[model samples]
Target: MIQPTKDEIRGWLSEARNELRSERFRRRLLEHELCSAKRALGNAVLKGQINVPIEKLGELVLKLQKESETEEADM
Candidate 1:
């Protein structure tokens, strides 16, 4: 397995900061480019990512812009 060096991760973060600020990520709710960090978070918190079990978290998704760009079959 290839794990990123600390400096590589830091470099990615710096680039991510620019992309997130300049690109559609902050505005678009459903889609963004995926990285290991994102994949890991999604896997760890998959349940709470959508149709969340907890009330407040569900409320948070509802309160924010929530839409499905792809069908369940795709994921």
Candidate 2:
């Protein structure tokens, strides 16, 4: 799977929140993607493939956390 940019992820999160009208739903989606990415990174690391940058990982994690907060507030 292709890695997504932080801006692309943020846009997707925003769109999901707006379209679903449920922050919880958006959070779930974000969580699933994050888990998938982590697994992919793990596999890549084991195989000596180029993994994602640390900075991008941090950004994605922060964004997921912020989105989770939004979900909590809406609930």
Model 1 deviation from native, Cα RMSD in Å: 15.9
- TM value for model 1: 0.29
The TM-score that candidate 2 achieves is: 0.40
Clashes of 2: 0
Question: TM-score: which candidate is best?
Answer: 2
lDDT (tens digit, per residue) of candidate 1 on 1-75? 999999999999999999887676554443444345556665667755544457865674564434343333456
Instruction: Report the C-alpha displacement of residue 9, candidate 1, in angstroms.
Output: 0.3
Worst 10 residues of 1 by lDDT: 64-73
Error of 1 at 25 (Å): 11
